[model samples]
Target: MLLLVAAVGILAVVGFVTFLKLSPQSTPISSQPSTSTKEVNALSLYHWWTSPGESAAINSLFGVFKNSYPDVAIIPAPVSGGAGFQIFPLIQSLVNAGEAPDAFQMHAGYEARPYYDAGLLEPIDALWQSEKLESVIPKVIRDMTQFDNHYYSIPVNVHRVNVVWYNQKLLKQNGIDASRLTTWDSFFAACDKLKAAGVKYPIQMGPTWTASHIFEQILASQGVSFYENFINGKILSAQDPTLNQALTTFKKFLSHVNPDNSTTVKDWDDAIRRIIKAEGAFSIMGDWANGEFKLIGMKHNTDYGTIPVPGTNDMYGLCIDTFQHPKAASHPTNSDRWLKVVASKAGQDAFNPIKGSIPARTDADVSLYDDYQKGAISDFNKSTYMYPSIVHGSGMPSSFKLKLNDIVDNFVQTQDINKAAVAIVNQIQSTLPEFTKVWSLE
Candidate 1:
């Protein structure tokens, strides 16, 4: 039965990919009204939400959309990657070919600006006012969804990136209280204790992007003020002592990491699997790890425990998932319909619980969310500082992001702190234009 179900799912995703090749010549009436009996209207939805929990969450939102517009079918085009690295480039290619999906998933901040600047995106400010989203969504989120005072996309959820997940049994066996890991000094000490207790890979991480994610968290741990300065360009990588400290600290972290699976594991969930099997003591990852945990029937605070990554208690690393309408959408009305559903409170309520993220809406019901989500919500509402995630395409431009990922990946493999620091400085020195452009847009 599982195999049969898996086959059906694969067939559905395959169908969506096939539809992307249907050119104007193939569908002569593609421009006609969706409700017209002569035309079959379909909305193509592209995203990386292919995991079990994410699939279920998206289905919940699609269910609401389908009920309201029974005549329209949603084509799901999901791609796999740690951080949409594999899928986003494909999305760019589709845009270049004028075959963009009706509504596609993207990060909320500077990530979407390149497409917007190229005149590939269509603004949804009219729907924003019509749906009265201003009352429900937070002002910061509203600001994030806009470029040049025009709302271009609707944010669906906010993912906190600096979460540390741990195997509760391993920690207990090692006589290390999880609460003591609130700072780097304590965390390293705990790693030592876990090593002494025979726990391998006390800190588990995946490939390229995961290393970047950890690097960002280490920078955040320096303090909110320093993080803001660093990301905002007030501080330079080579000139700032704190930046050097962060790189050095991250390099030290690699020593405790299990080298055996560093190359073998490529997905974030794979690292979570190691922690689940008790082979690793802890993993610093985004809250989405909770979704994977639930997929395998692991209960939070029981089989696992979570905390803010060391020295980041009052800070939230933002990774918002949003949907944007392309100017070249074949079915503009259908795209609007999809966006309306995604931006609605009902949509957030249906999707966020399963996706392991807090609703972007400030007015969402807290009771519907799990304990971790509720905690995220509470922190988001009153956090001392909120910073965009560098690894998730918000803090830096796409060009700088790719370079930083390459640097972090190399650093992870070589564990050469000085070389990594110089590489980062050189990249930042050369790619300041890209970074500056993104910052100015904000």
Candidate 2:
């Protein structure tokens, strides 16, 4: 609680700080849109995907959207930092000022709750029915789009959150049997073997957000029922054994990670680079990191490979990315057009393959996707249990998640399991009122 209060205080004193986002194909800092501005033949799209692979993927979708509607220009304003961390507050300010973009990147599920609760977003139920999405998109994904009995967002791609990416060559050289590492205990034993063989940092991680991400993976590996309660705001007590146990496991995970902080690793991609260079053995990042590996010409199952964050093997951890319609959109028609392309089979096929995610629509052409994505599609189909990701903003309130970043970061430094568990429970209690959306992920 003190952590958030102190953060709010700093923001109040310094005023709003906007990060510098420079791009040849981006909106300049001087020309940020205003609510009362007249609608042009342009669609202002706000997102936070500025990385090499991420940028290419979004641009591919832009090309698809353009082929159909070349008249409607796309103004890409990508605010890049900490994944979505730096963009969230800026978007909040814009939305509060009624300057919301025509359409912006929104993670499906509770991440879109505040907008829908405040009635700032327009539901797209008509599109769902017209496009026959009900039959094409999976039920779990469809449910993620709906809140208060209306669909508010259109998911473009789905990322598996519980993936543990590692250098396959390193494990083979170390004589560790990768196939047998099916549970956390066995996984840690492999790490132990690597450590004994002079691999100082068996795991590589970057920044606080990455730490929170791996922590969520550990929590999800606790099983679907416990994780479902976690996202639904049901983990209310600090004494909850499962919660505590997860924190303990996360502590062990941090011990194996690189000693360098952000200055050294910088971001999640850097950690994957460490694995590629054989400086580290593993990285617990989403499949987005696969895009980076591919960008560098690394082949799957040869140079690197992934397994479900140990103990989460048949489970598909959800990190769905969607676009929403704002009630005060400047170019309403363009927004609708963008949503259509986002939901289209062609657009998804172009975007997700380069983006390292599976199309939300189950009927996508699998041949366009690589082996990792093909396998992900198979896993998405077989998994009856889908867990929402906390670090990625698909689960819990924004308040809870903001506070959680600090708690987990502190735990990484202190390795204090009990303290992290208590702090997390307290933050959950304080943010209970904000958790109005009830998730039915069983």
Candidate 3:
């Protein structure tokens, strides 16, 4: 059975390589060549975008694609979870069994390396060249989309991960000056005051990913140089003094989170909802939470307000939404067709406005974006300290990420700074064997 598995794997690699060499161009949007409402049958797409706001944004893209490829059936398999943690392993299983979806969502960085290296992905260099992506996509993000010199995915939107949103009413009612709290010291002081004013949970929180999400923002908040150093593997362990401080501070911050957390409200949207309703003072989440507010017709700055995670004003923590093609896709042509639309300016314009994320395309219709998005776009252009999010699949591999999530979740539950710091180093050491070649942990 082991031999059979190895043989199958080898064959898959050979087949994919040959296909890469033979395929001259990706299935362009013009492939259908007709505007008839003929069904080309179903194509399964797996993603984790079941939230109200997420669905609206994704459906916007569907509306565009359906107009062109009216015959091709597009089946959506949306799982409910932030960061697709529940769906990542499931995708691996489908790939292993040669039953992969036509196309699936992926983070366009080291996270895609394992699948690409395993011959489970279809290269889209043809599509990139035909679409002239180099001229439009930012060089930094475009570079991350490639593996082994081939582009394999299309980035749709970019979400800022290091944002703190608060109910404006709550802030005013509690005599809090949101603008003055630009550092952790000031932020925590405000949290203290909010607490004294009988604000039970000043900061709304969700489950493991939410905790890990805030931790990364806090880690980056220390210093962009330090955050970049850690992500680049220049800082070897969590035992490092700066990282220790961040971890200890993380433990301190947890006390402000609502005690009726995770068990009652396990979704980030729920946490955001609490903030919007004036029941909670704040929520540290990605800009997608802004989309949730927009979905309910809530106005920004009035209903809710946003600030960079304290001390991260000059930094932009990015969480890019990208999609990848599977080598064993039952509908490869349809998959590429779908991706073509995702990479187009029109699709990005339609999608990002409803998604509360900025378009990945540089030429997107910025006029169509809201105030929050306009602010994010301006920051994306100006921020000197832009970095991909560690918690959101841009900074680490699956195994290491899973390990980090486990440690952080445990730490959130226990509030043990020393143990958490030690566990981080230990886990990284164990994970190094699988990642040393890819990571620069010198």
Candidate 4:
């Protein structure tokens, strides 16, 4: 009886040990899947920077990524078109065809909002958290890229939208000192001098979007709080007397622009040509225009001087650009590796200088930039004068942009101030619903 009981006990112990070995939790470590070993092989990147200078700038970034990941091959697919032409249609087609690149550069505004809403954009929240981008990029830029508590895109640099690039020789010839013109009245006074001196086009303006940008500058100078209130739908219409005054101020400036000014000159390159040849005494445009000036061998603060848009106290505004990542072909590992490299510190440092804007990273040293860029960086540090570009913010989607373009085009052509004001009011009323919907989502 004792031997039979001992034999049963030994069998039970052996059975229990066999069951433990077969359990899922007890699988050998080598047999389990490992996430760390995953690798990316190749990446396809798409962007709209075809200009020689822009290509050079972007190549520097690509070079750095290659250095870091020599094993991962990068295929750059560049799309031609300066900033504002529609590239979305092409991207939409590619996505529908199941050929979306691993990553593409997009605007930071409502232009990107649709992609985020559609779930086409991969939320970089996980990557941002891992990299602590919040601590690296400036709060303003970080805030601009984020929507609904998540970052949708990365801003490579910040460009001042409300800049008035002027011909130093032209201004001096007219005895008009740009320094004394801090307010709208003084700015208009200078324009009057230019006009009186037979400067046919005292201001070079064009591109439907640029007209809207000018309107935004006027609105911001009035007071960004006022602009925000209207944009948020707190003030329903432009019927407010303040709105009328802003419209009037814009119309007055419109009168001094080129007579042939129409949306037809809807290209920055065309505007640059007019400026370089001194056909237009001044141009109210973004700092990116500096690239054109540089190409023409114009010296900053000498051949041309940059000033805040007339009547605005701030020298800074929206900074916009795109980042491209390698396309994920057969190798998911290569695609992932390229994404990681673009988001790294070395990548930003290599790209921003050639791109002509301060690095999106706040910790970057601005001393490496040119004098104009250094000044821009210093002004941005102040933070008090900064506001996002309207086109980059709520001002874009409300269809108010289209209406403002119409108003400016009309005001410039016919000089009908009252009609322009009324048109603006109607646009405000029509755009309020869309504007409210977007802001509420925020």
Among these predictions, the greatest TM-score belongs to 1
Ranking according to lDDT, highest score first: 2, 3, 1, 4
Candidate 3 error regions (>4 Å): 1-40, 436-442
lDDT of 1 by residue, 1-442 (tens): 0011111223434533423333233433333335644434777767888767778888989998988898775667777776766656666677676666788888877678677777878888899999999998888778778888899999999999999999998888778889878888899999988887777568888877888899999988998777776666556557578888898889888888867545788677788889989989888989988888877888888888999999999888999989988876756778989999998888889889988999988888889998878878888888878888877877877777778889888888788777877888787777667654333211
Clashing pairs in 3: 40-71
Write the residue-wise lDDT of candidate 2 on 1-442 in tens digits: 0011111122121232322222344433212346676445667777878778898899999999999998765666676665476655666666676566678888887777766766678989998888888898988889889887899999999999889898989999999877788888898899999999999999999988898888888888898888888877789889999998898888777778888955687788788888989998989888888788888888999888888888888788889999988876756878888999999999999999999999999899999999899999899888877788888887888778878889888987898877888898888878888877676667
Q: Would you give me the overall lDDT of model 2?
A: 0.81
State the lDDT of candidate 4 residue by residue for 23-125, as single tens digits: 3332222211256844334455567666555677779888987887776556566765445344566555555555556667776665565565555665567
Top model number, lDDT: 2
Could you tell me every candidate's TM-score relative to the true structure?
0.90, 0.89, 0.88, 0.79
What lDDT does candidate 1 reach at residue 47? 86
Task: Write out the backbone clash pairs for model 1.
Answer: none
Better of 1 and 3 by TM-score: 1
Question: Among all windows of ten consecutive residues in candidate 2, which has the lowest summed lDDT?
Answer: 1-10
- As a whole number from 0 to 100, the lDDT of residue 323 in candidate 3 is 88
RMSD list, candidates in order: 4.5, 6.8, 8.6, 15.7
Candidate 2 stretches with Cα past 4 Å from truth are 1-39, 96-98, 440-442
Q: What's the CA error at residue 245 for candidate 4, in Å? A: 1.8
